[model samples]
Target: MDPRYFFFILFTLPTLLFGQINENGIKGYFSFDICEAVDTTDVIFSDYGGGVSGNIIRQAGAMNCVMDCSIRGNSFSMNGLDEQIVFFSGFQSVFNTSDFSIGFYFRPDPGVTKMNLFTKAEMCADSASFTIDYNPSSNQIEATLAQNSSIRTKVTGKLDPDRCWQHVTFVRDDRNSILYINGEQADLATASTRINAKNSSVLVLGSNLCIDRFRGLIDEIAIYDRAINANDVDDLFFHPEEIINRDTTIFLGGSVQIALSKNCADSYQWSPNAEINDATVAEPLISPTATATYQVDMISSDCTAKDEIMITVLDPDDLDCTEVFFPKAFTPNSDNLNDFFRINNPYTIDELISFEILDRWGSRVFFTDNPFEGWDGNFDGQVVNPGVLLYRVRFVCKGVEQTQVGSLTLIR
Candidate 1:
């Protein structure tokens, strides 16, 4: 094999790398192709007849497998009923390597279902060994290594399969094995079934014993001759096309235009039911009637990404209507200019304290008992003539007394 292919297989076979050791210590590592496939019929090792299907494909001149499977159903399962349907490549020689590592890339279909893919022995006997399995019943992926028959280290969680393709790696030093998901250290298992496999014993995949076979696809199986590090596992998932960074927002109208970080997907779907259908463009203009949260699912030929935003429609009639104040001055005259004294009030007043119009002679000309009633240059049922009128007013505001004094010009 070419040197580049060998390096590719060494780095990209496991999803994660852990327990990296130097010349002084023991180190473990692993990786796999999330989109590639492995064919067991061609290899000379134990053949459980496990093959690849669905989005599984081959990369040219690369030693890893890549899976392009879509996330539709609740579970991604491999039919292990037929022994050779799905299995690993080399389980017999798992312990022969003094320092070893393993990793693989996977995108579990949404929902619940468990599957097993690989296992290894420490010495020559299979009595005590390590195993990695996915439990669909519990929505957890777990790894078990032999520390003792009584106690072992195991890590499990409900990982959202819809998020993205994730790399899972586990590394075993002499004393302990560390689990890692997506380049991050996970829980550790100290007391595990210690591996005891003989040298030259073939490594096995797809089956734990004669049963417990894997019910999913496998690809890019690789066993490093030496231990590797976490950085090595991260490289498998660092494809330039897999990183998606886009800013998505929603306005009153259902219009979305997001610039993606990479170019792999060509279609998008907005949530909250858009007015127009069949609009699969990356940035589609849509209008939703009610206020709602919207999410966009971007689909590539091989993978999918999604984001969400919220939309809220406001009522147009929600306006401001407050009291408007006009200067307490007006010239009421027959000249057709400022013919009336009025107060521009937009709100209803609760009370009228006092309203009085006084002439220049310092005598009251008019007064009002109603807050809405304004002086029309009239007093005692008689129209007052043109002159300068002084008005003194007092009113109660919020139970507090307030007063104002102004003059009005009446010319008629």
Candidate 2:
């Protein structure tokens, strides 16, 4: 084995051990650090010797480390005999005996006509491998995996070929193998295959058939010795961010409930004080009397986490009318005190249809359609002499008829 291969194998051993085990004890894994044909000048390293590298020419907001490799003319190629480009990592050595998974960001080189990007293993060589390749003539990205020829799976698609990064995964459980692209299961040639390879070699990145190299970008390569389910893969692809931040404003007498992204810590703290602090509590009810700002902070076991929602409690009555109303007499005496007869009901009346004042003679001295336009003891827009007047009011209240009749002394 090449010294670089030995070092790669040594570095990847921990991935097989770190994953949470299922009943069958399988691990998941991935990696994309190989000297393929594609350039790697602008790759961003997450840690020492690990990060993302690929050529992204078009799509804006394309991740620097996580890019589509199958775009532009850039690609991984292997033309020389015995030339091997190891492009991926995170695969367990033994197959058929242990469940395992591999996932990474990939982009197919549009220029290549035939390509494969997955893992495979050959019993003849006692090797396991994964590969991603493209054929320029076919305009396809093919993924293949094998364990000593005993277990093999292949999936293909007419990919975007625009060199845009897409997420992909290949998983092997006790009885099945699957391929996923962009977090969804892609078509496969087979689902069930028995692995017979023992002590499989370290995972290969970038190349499969010793000279068949991938010419694209790869990022966030991860591997697990444990087999992961569809839901797990979905979570990994869609909600990779550790923290969740949200904000909500609710009316008084109303409530709000928040849902955090998955795989988050179960510890929670709600500001303005909550009835409960448990993270999984659904619909934690809180009734705030006054306007309050509530916050929920969640902490994961890894001590890395985020918060969801700054809940702002609003006062329902803040939108209510609080003005005072008082009974008044209209004198029409040019005295400001009783010049107009008006009732104050700031919260009660929206509009008045008609308000009229009639003399003992039964003639109308004042009438108005506006609630604000009260009886100023006027006739035809002219002030009338002060005297006792009978008033009749007909108005609409809450879409209903309301009639009020009374006598008022309009003194001059």
Candidate 3:
């Protein structure tokens, strides 16, 4: 047996934030950490609380996988030759054609070409299998769910191979199937036919029936019985450090609103909850007397990530703190991408007295007192034309009333 040619399969969970992934619709959760030698046979367990576990069939003489541990922990290392993990139980509901989601983290080997990341197909026509493959040559992810080769739904998305671990999720919401790479929608396809994989068939990771095996470290394999929404996908794909960039200062006794990029988590816990108006919410207003680190534990489905911001309370007399950031431009075309004119960092302002927008003719087009509230490019029940608009904002920063005038381009 070539020591480097042996496969390792683990049935234990890694050190998650709270515990194992406890998502409601999760049918199968495989945390490929901690290897156990069981009668010279490697086994894999679907550890979604009380889900059924299965033995994993591996290629001959594959070494016990324990290399390049990413954030998700120990992973199965495939040699791209023949090593694969075969799970043949409790995976039928996971391949629901109507609404389902499947995700996993993988770090591909350098220069890997066409290789299968997941497959659950049998020789039988009624087996109705699904497979996710990565093709580095085209830099795309090709996926297919089929009742047979003749009746299938195919989808592909851009997949740029990175040296670090990357997340990929395929979500089937009704007839639309969206492929998300690292929390963002990479591609979408409408499925013309319904397909579901039968439980009797084996679910194979790292290789397809065509013998195109994967060459990478795969971990945190998960299967959802429902189509996990974009928010859940974001929570799973992004870590806390990747999202929170607020390590800032605040005037003593002044409150600041701290928030995440998206507030879609199931629950939130702000450590040292005192001095915070609402610690359980995604965005919390905090008035701290002393300098301290506030950490928020964001929990969504089976994933948990936490980010902390060190609030350095400073006296207004010792520092010059009277500046408000305004966005130079905004687009209100209703694409849900930057469609509102809002303050960039409203936390710096203690209180926004009024924010007013005026047309070139000095007509009041929009007015609001909330720093978070934005102008929707509407005036007198009609969307205004794209043009440069003047803005006058009155806000209190560090107990000092400040007025700022600026012009922003409104893009249609």
Candidate 4:
């Protein structure tokens, strides 16, 4: 691998990185290539991590094992009868966390219903478990994380597979559960639940403990200890090279041109065409009024790669010359209109530093630091004689402070 590839993979943050798997938080990676030897019976070793090897146990059906690099390189083909690949060790601590991601590429056999694609659960008793399955009854794929047979979060989405390779991933990031299909977010839910898989259960692929056996070709399976971001998922789905610039930032009212490397893709489709000059072109000029994220699908004959760029728009806050008004006069006679001596245009003020009202002798009769409170033309529990009262207000507007002094006439 070129040294530049490391630089691109380590630093660049995008929706997808092409050609390589993200190794930042990877716990186990199974490519199932020809290079991985089967030492005992049908045990296939994981390429990057040990102790999570595939122990193929075929109770019935003919065996089909082959390597195909075009579609995610080498695959584990299942015959759907009673065949499964079980990993009997080293996954208890991997899935017993608050953040994790599991992804793979699979091409299911046509008409396969109620098949379990992946599972990690204890069959003896109801405990914390995780599973992903395809149901023909609902024509949907469901991903569930549960405890004691009770679902913590279950996300379901449409997955109409026509015997073609498709990528699917389930992620748990803190309280958020996300499911991604073909580099796009399919479903999302929020739940801060713990998945306690600290039992004698093991991880199984292509079946759920010998039940609901999956008939398909599975490849490029990966497990991450942390939540693999959408960008990482895209990179895994459609491996592409560095074809565009990193995310950009611009001031409000400014324009930017997002361009791709020369000869990256045969066709382009940019989303959120609102503020861009052209959405069908590789390089479009955009002048968005607010901060927004733009995603573009680079389509070629081989694969469709997707990427996104976030444009952060900054608008500074400066003080405006609109002053807050103090009522010039008011009547305490109980008429609703102008009955209290209060401040007007209070929306223009952000904070009240100090507000005080005093009589002619300079003695404080009413005082409050609250901007919403005002005097009601009363002093010593009785309405003061109709006379002029002094008011001093110190307040802040748009983070800048200013003081205003004026006289208010009280009427009976």
In candidate 1, how many Å is residue 312 off? Answer: 15
Give all candidates' CA lDDT scores: 0.47, 0.49, 0.70, 0.68
Give lDDT tens digits, candidate 1, residues 1-412.
1111111122211222322322222212222312232443111111111121111112233322222342211112333543322222433444532445566545543434455555654342334556677676775568765434554455554544444445566666554666676556766655434444333323444444533556544432334444556666554333322223233333344444333333235676656555635446555544555555656666755456666555454332332222324345566555556656755441233345677778888888777756556676777778877767787766654456666677766655
For 1-412, candidate 4 gives per-residue lDDT tens digits of 1111000001222223224667787666666654343332333333555334345665432334446322544566777776776765556567775588989877666663588988887762456777889776765779877666654778887763322456789998876779997778999987656555455567777765635788867777777879999879987775322336677766578988876643335678888889999998888998988889888776655445567788877553432434768767898887677877777745456788888898999988888877678788787897788888889888887668898888989877
- State the displacement of the C-alpha of residue 227, model 4, in Å, after optimal TM-score superposition: 0.9
What root-mean-square deviation over C-alphas does model 1 reach?
23.1
Better of 1 and 3 by lDDT: 3
Q: Rank order by lDDT, top first?
A: 3, 4, 2, 1
Error of 2 at 364 (Å): 52
Name model 4 segments beyond 4 Å from true: 1-19, 35-46, 50-54, 59-63, 68-70, 124-126, 149-151, 160-163, 195-197, 239-412
Q: Tell me the spans in candidate 1 whose CA falls farther than 4 Å from its real position.
A: 1-78, 83-97, 107-113, 121-126, 191-201, 208-211, 220-222, 239-243, 246-268, 272-294, 298-412
| Model 1 residue 250 CA deviation in Å | 13
In candidate 1, clashing pairs total 63
Who is ahead in lDDT, 1 or 2? 2
lDDT of 4: 0.68
